[model samples]
Target: MKKLALAVVVTMASSLCAMAASDVTKSPPPAPYEQVSKLVKLPDFLPGMGALFVDPATLPAGPFLAYDHGGKLVSTIYMLPIKDLNPDKRFDNLAAPGGNVDHVDVYYNAGHPGVPEPHVHVVLWHVPAADEARVAK
Candidate 1:
């Protein structure tokens, strides 16, 4: 009877340990922005100033900036290619009739491995009316 009780206790303990280990490994990994935000400082020009978007479930990363003519945030720039960007192609298109885009900056993960894979930090800046130096400010 003593041996049987000991065997049952050991089996229960082993089963619990296996369950805990599986839980740890089955959980999704932490998001990249959570990791990057801790390391880098986003440029001051960034309007909404916050962590860039990066859904691990989705490949690539983005800190896209899409604002209205009045400087209101329209939406975040996703991973759409430059060629596919249309209708609102030029900086003037995004700004109010009179208001010009000073510059636009986007952050991404440069280390992105490839399609369906992970990446590192990547930043894309667009200055429709001015040069890089002018845009930096």
Candidate 2:
């Protein structure tokens, strides 16, 4: 099961890396979103990462954007508490070798500025240590 989950995460990470490499014009995330972005100092671009994003209506401050190495938009990161999600069908585990034990919520198309018309939204919460270790490794 661990291996299976790891494989899934690997696949997802691969998907993230090879994502839609669009040139998202840098802009402040919409109104309410700006407050948190300011608080976190979420950069328009992170060192080693292509870009950062914040979608306006996502809960708990984001569907924060994380672009691919090529500066194309890919996954989103959300720092949400476990209590907010459904207990059943959830996957909040300790991070695997290179995977997340966190809950993941995905969205398709849905339209947001800078994102391509057919895009994806990846929500993350409570990631595990295992996953963290892989990133650092």
Prediction-by-prediction clash tally: 13, 4
Model 1 weakest lDDT span, ten residues long:
24-33
For 5-62, candidate 1 gives per-residue lDDT tens digits of: 9999999999997664333111121233232222344432433332233334333324
**Across residues 32-111, which tens digit of lDDT does each residue of candidate 2 receive?**
43333344545445543235555455544345554444433333454443343456534354221212325555555444
How does candidate 2 fare on TM-score? 0.31
Clashing pairs in 2: 53-65, 93-101, 95-128, 95-131
Name the runs in model 1 displaced over 4 angstroms: 28-137
Per lDDT, the best of the predicted structures is 2
